[model samples]
Target: MSESIDIVYEALGRYIDGLCGSTYIGTARGMVVLYRGAEIHHLTPLKEPLPFLNLFYRKGTVEIVGVWREEKSEAFFLRAAAADVRLFEDERTISIITYPRTGDMQERGMLIITLHANMGMAKTLKSIIQEETRFIKKEEVVISSRVSI
Candidate 1:
């Protein structure tokens, strides 16, 4: 049997809107890439970002963290919000795959995610995503994030 996957696209779009001087979150769906090996995958049949955000939201706040690319362990906790999640040569992308503390069979397949930003906001968003480049494992990474910077 093939399992269904819930994809996140709009929240990141909204977040990008917020960054782009929009008072309201626009309807544009954010750009996200999911891939296996060198073949990029598309996220079809789009869904709202609320359900996905709800998974990590707590106490009226949600924390975004980046997992070290070399980490092979399947178990982990959301210890803290990462200062930056960018893990690509292109400054516009931010990796969003985090390791869960429990290896729930149901919560499978967050393998690789990288978010690409709009070219216009590249300068503004780059600083927020800036981090040490050595931690990035580009060749094997799949990326996802807001569509800014």
Candidate 2:
């Protein structure tokens, strides 16, 4: 199963690179590695994969967070409008919130990504949603005065 997961991750990396023309970064255990056309970022064991959530976004950026098997869990959330990515853990779930990006209307758009994992699969399940928030427009008021102040 771990081998299959590795293949899946490799395929995912290739797919992402092909789609965005950006390099893919992967981690396992505690090491980090980068993948390009025919190159590898690191050669040492430190380049090995990690057992946590890996996030890919904005062409060449990847973020990873640690997870405890017995204590807590980790997940990734993305906000497209703000070009923001969030790493949420079990302890911080209450403080988790998504906001709009500056220079844009507060209700413009949002894209959310959530990841979940189990014990045996060695894979993560991702859920994505694209949505728009609507706001009511306010109209200016005009006052008329008949005769005199």
Best by lDDT: 1
Give the per-residue lDDT of model 1 (tens digit) for 13-92: 33443345332211222333333335544332133331121113222221322221121211111211223233343554
Report lDDT (CA) for all predictions: 0.29, 0.28
Give, for candidate 2, the lowest lDDT window spanning 10 residues.
140-149
TM-score of each: 0.27, 0.24
Measured with C-alpha atoms, the lDDT of residue 32 in candidate 1 is: 33
Model 2, position 12: C-alpha lDDT score: 48
**Residue pairs with backbone atoms closer than 3 Å in model 2 (clashes):** 27-49, 27-50, 28-49, 28-50, 29-49, 29-50, 29-51
On the 0 to 100 scale, the lDDT of residue 113 in model 1 is 38
Model 2's C-alpha root-mean-square deviation from the true structure amounts to 22.1
Q: Please report the candidate that would top TM-score against the real structure.
A: 1
Runs in model 1 lying further than 4 Å from the true structure = 1-29, 33-84, 87-108, 111-117, 131-149
lDDT digits (tens) for residues 17-50 of candidate 2: 4346532233234322323235443211222243
